[model samples]
Target chain A: MNDRIYMDNCVTSAMAPEVLEAMKPYFGEEFWYPGSFVSTGEASSAAFEGFREVIADALNAAPQEITFTSGGTIANNIALKGLALAHSGEGRHIICSTVDYPDLLTHAAYFEKMGFEVTYLEPDELGFVSAQKLKDAIRDDTILFMSTMVNHVVGTIQPIGEYSQVLAAANHKIWFHVDAGQAFGKLHLDVKALGMDTLSVSAHKIHGPQGIGALYVKKGSRLGAYIHGIKRFEGVQPGGLSLAAMAGFAKAVEIVYKDLDGSIKQLRELSDYLLEQLESQIEYVELNGPRGEGRACHNINVSLDFIEGEAITIMLDMHKITVATGSACASQGLKPSYVLLAMGKNQVQAHGSMKFTLSRYNTKEQIDFTVAKLKEIAAILRERSPLYNAIKKKQEK
Target chain B: MQYSEKVLQHFMHPQNVGEMENPDATATEGSPACGDQVTMYLKVDKENLIIEDVSFLSYGCASNIATASIITEMAKGKSLEEAKKITWRDAMEALDGLPPVKAHCSVLAADTLQTAISNYEIAHGLKEVPDFSKETIIGELKKIIYPQVGEDIITLKMVKYVGFEEKTGEVLIDLNLMSFDQYRDNVAEEIREHLQKYPEVKDIKINFPS
Candidate 1:
């Protein structure tokens, strides 16, 4: 009936037209790889350096510190494994939270299998892992710690500054790595200010093209090579990366960093409006994450009582809207969202949770239409819900 | 895995979906904790032993709702004996096919319908309440789908052995699932939920291949 309304920007976003325009030339005649002497190669090398500078500038790091990777997952692998391999001789203990992103958790599992001990810090009910907990979990043999800057599921922004302070107080060096795939453009990140030894960010999360991301390894940190294939450019991740995609990533970074404050403000307003509308229009809706500034600007997660999230997601899809749900039925593994469960939410709450991640493209009108359609869907589904009927009967009694 | 066009049609616009007032017989299957629960209501023609009307209320995913809707449609005009023959496979065939992971929804819908029919027959003095025993435990196990293959564990031979200690109300099951099987946890959780409803099963221990 209408153009597809995409609200799942946290997974991937619509590439900006400007980024495509910037990438076109690289895909065409300027596609030469970086070289030592050839004119075309030198020019390509200079352009590559310039693109790296754009991303480094956003993070207040040098161009040489940035290593381009295929995506956030690869970047995470390189930084995390590199840190582990380089420092495992020093200590075989790692620390992370139970509610961290899957990338970090999987890496933790791998480390555990490699004869390293891992301590998972528990998060508060609102999904915040306190720095005090991190300090307490630290041991004499703890050598590394990894955290997700902005939680992908609930959008809880962890206390990175306090975490860095705690790690600094440790007697032994504890390398800190951050998975900032969801935080890159949404928040102002200064690698030096955050005191993270290594960090990862993806281009697609900020209106850039997919299949391109960057890893920031703070200067003076020795990371063992994770990917060893070729000597194409100097970086931990070896092999040739797409010049066109890097150009697009640079363009996307420039656009967002150009007015980062303004973009964040707009997203916050849109999400606030959406949450407000849902609360006012719907009955028995509960917010899953923290309210106000503690949560990310783009994410709004809420649980609708008496209705399963998969049904709601499909009904909204029929209305030409796209969103995410935490229901076990929607998952390939047939398990509820681990993030919500880790936050002490019951299975029903997790099953009914709906996630709406806004972007620069969303508007007030779109939010209005979505909330209205969602209200109708909730009412329709509730009419056919035994849970709701049972409640009504109980109240009648 | 995607739903068939028929399944989507039924899910988007399910038939006979509502709360039935003054139903002759009713049964609810599954649980809210499992993320799916279905309640079925039936009005039977006592003289003719035919199902005069049928309705259902579902709290679950699209497939769960669609299966319940189609099961009600299939049972509406059938005799009690005829309705008793309707299995989850019939519902799956009626809806073209369902994803393997969602095949359990059909089982839940069919199970609810059969239970409603049993309730009616018992109330009408046509049959006695079945005794809960080892056979009853095995019958419930037959309803637990493997999810990955869209087949029950009993049919797939995943159930290595089933033991019941009637005096202690303890049930033991040895499964052939490997320790690394992705569906290992799902199948075990399903078994517990299915058997926990029976008063005879006070405890369950599921053994997997280490």
Candidate 2:
């Protein structure tokens, strides 16, 4: 019966009101198959292509190079698998960081099965891969360099611009892919400035409708096709994307950039307040990701000793507060976050990891309320942990 | 997120959510690889060979807690020998079957129960558990988790018997279990697929008589 408080923005955001309003006409009166020659359909097609131009302009890429897909997962799949296949003859070896999103990892796994070699380079203890190490990782036959704009679990925003420059200097025109699903709307992304051959973005992460996302493919990039269908989005994405959803996604991006500074300031202040409260109000807790600007502006991850992440998540849910956990039990893979593990956390530490991602809509009041609930839950769960009890007993001596 | 009704009932109102003091035996099963763990305690009547009571603490997902809770429900009054026959499949069936992805939660519960039983066996100096196979049981179990494709049961420490006749091509398993006297055959079906592939394992028998 408590008020619902959502801290799972990294998972998905509620659609922005402006986005909803823009998409309304498309759902009913403006419903038409894009690219059709008929009047209504032609109008729909123009609008669809118009947003495509807007997104391309945002990324500083040619409109012809922008392709729409189902969402972040599909965008990533196309980028990784498509580029790997397209460049296999150039070399079978690929350089990738361990903190890459699981979707990219899964695709790397598939590539490995196909006889392409992938080197899973680990980042430093702070979830960072140095440019020098990345450059050194480039083998003579290394065909691609893939990482993410941000670490999904801990919100460590990878320095994409620096790493892309390293790759460019190491191997000219090497396929550099960045899965920017979490970072796209929160951070400024320019394909030219970052020197990235491809980048992936999802609409829902920016308060747009689900099932709509875009990939910025550099104009000269030789990316192959993954899905076999009509060349709907410039011969890359097969099958048509949801026209209404695409319009909604474009408006979402517009509103995000139009109010970019204000939103960023609000989210930064909100997350900063949360971290301060969590640190000052709780005991036996440690933040997982980097502390300040090195991290994403919208998220925070912390590990609480003597308690499982799922236990805390469930307990918090009972109080009408929502967050996310990557503990073995919390994940569908039944694995602790490889991202956290690669960053040097032990099993227990990884199992206790909890993440809270904020949105522009979040308020200072919600952070205070959630922190109070977390303190209460931590005390109760610590009381149940035998390890905590044993440690207390030993301390008594 | 769409858990079964049974999972919701057990997770929302979990039973035996604490530890016991001075237990006859205790065991913990968890791996850094999975990031989930369950530590179980047992109070056993050594002379009568019954599991008097059981309790557990888990750092895992909803299924992990639910599965552990249900196993304690199933094993509370059972004999230790009977409790040893409790399989993860029993817990799966009791919860009306876990989501396939969460099947491992029941496997964790079952494995931890076996580890607790083994701990009991060690503390009381009961005779070492009978060999599950002619070959070193641990080595053969390393080849697989169950008779099926999941986790390897050897590392899980739940293998009870593996009988193979080279000449007659007959394979039999005592089949480690954590619950459900009636769910033995379902587990058997999984084992049959695993062992039946071999030219030597012409016939397979999983003896779980309820």
Candidate 3:
């Protein structure tokens, strides 16, 4: 297959060369378990410490505050469920936005099933969950307030710090969890600045290997009460970590932070140019996330009426262009995105959703190719559709 | 995940997906609930008793679109009656296996073909046609009563299923209620009153669910 235009980077990015090189040594010559007490294994333990330091430095977290997990989903589950279970005696009420990733909500759902009262806050039209909305939704019994910074599907950055300030002022003693899977390498993150108790990140998302991720557990935060452990960084995770993937994670973060300015600038330019090009070819193609500030520079989800996103995606894949209809995790369900539904789009518009996420590897030429192919596919599908005819009829009348 | 080679083959090289300019029959199935609809066209040779061509246009997910394409290929050379008999299972098999959640897609494909055959019969003035009026009204009523569990209400023997007088709007319904719950009765009564608002419904009969 000719170099397929990879648009599903939000699902997983091509591993960065530097990160790959960093992982190679650990996979072969230095492949020793960090937990081993043997004299030669001391180097592995030191390498593990270096991995923790890199992640800690990136997030402005204490090295002791970071806990490695299998991936973002597990980190999210741990954050939500661990908090709910540990604090269930304190208060059983948890408030989270409906726009949060379903896997995150699934963890919260388990709590709901276990007899906790959950209030799923809905985001506003632009995928913004306002601080006032959080304030109003908070109950006296609410013990946790959770949200995702930069929703993975739409890539809209939430006002985490603003919302956290309100929770801080109320002195509500609520544990705050921020699922920063999409935001990890793409944007700045500081655990203290956000006032969040727990934050999640995945390795593959930042051009590292899959099955390795980390969580930021702010020191003295309420979340620590829930996820307690004596071994391996205080027991947030009980098992010995994958030292090899961790090696990749550390290198990936190092590269991102080192080239953060240039990478983010390229992502923004590609995203802006792609949107501009798409707007020229398609009618009523509304950008689904934040139109200006508060949007992640790497993602652009759009809803184009008269075209089913799945059809466009298949046709694009045929042209060797890879993209996604929605979040890959829930794409198979065929339901209009719950995130978009919570953001106030009706079923038809929500079903016709497509997400274009840029990585450091994406370029302007690739974006141009994608837009042209998408235009052709969308136009062809629309021409064959009777619903498109009805829509056109309504527009004309 | 990598799909089986059969899936990728059908997906990558879909057989038929366009309109028939002069179709022997046309069918359109509308899924108002999910709002994903499909219209299919077929060219059948009556003397030969085989489909000469098949095509479809779908406004749905990838699985739905792919099912339509696969159905068109599968029905291309079959007789009208044989084509109409294409089950959701057969369509799914042609594509190896669709994700189970999307098995309903194959049903949509079959329904679209049935609708096109019905259209062809109407246009050609087939003398003896199945009376679709009663089933159509009942299907519409079921759509309102049991939005999520439409299939369940269909199986229940509680309502007095009736075919109404076309012009007078009078229904000959027999209702059976096995349970005496007020909530259940209220739902039944609401459906009854809503149907009465239609000009063609004049009278109804009730037999308590036994």
Best-fitting candidate, scored by DockQ: 1
Worst 10 residues of 3 chain B by lDDT: B143-152
Ranking by TM-score: 1, 3, 2
The model with the greater lDDT, 2 or 3, is: 2
Which ranges in model 3 have alpha carbons more than 4 Å from their true place? A34-38, A222-236, A327-330, A391-397, B1-26, B32-35, B41-55, B62-83, B89-101, B120-210
The TM-score measured for candidate 2 stands at: 0.79
Q: Candidate 2 DockQ category?
A: acceptable
- Chain A TM-score for each candidate, in the given order? 0.99, 0.96, 0.93
Q: How well is candidate 2 docked (DockQ)?
A: 0.23
Interface RMSD of every candidate? 0.6, 6.3, 7.0
Give the share of true interchain contacts found in each model.
0.89, 0.39, 0.46
Stretches of model 1 off by over 4 angstroms after superposition: none
Pitting candidate 2 against candidate 3, the one with the higher TM-score is 3
TM-score of each: 0.98, 0.79, 0.81
Compare the candidates by lDDT and give the number of the best one.
Answer: 1
Per-model CA lDDT versus the true structure: 0.93, 0.78, 0.74
Residue-level lDDT of model 1, residues A1-397, one tens digit each, is: 2498999999999999999999999999998988778899899989998999999999999888999999999999999999999999999999999999999999999999999999999998899999999999999999999999999998999999999999999998999999999999888899989999999999999999999999999989988888889878874267888999999999999999999999999999999999999999999999998998889999999999998999999999999999999999999889999999999999989999999999999999999999999999999899989999999899999
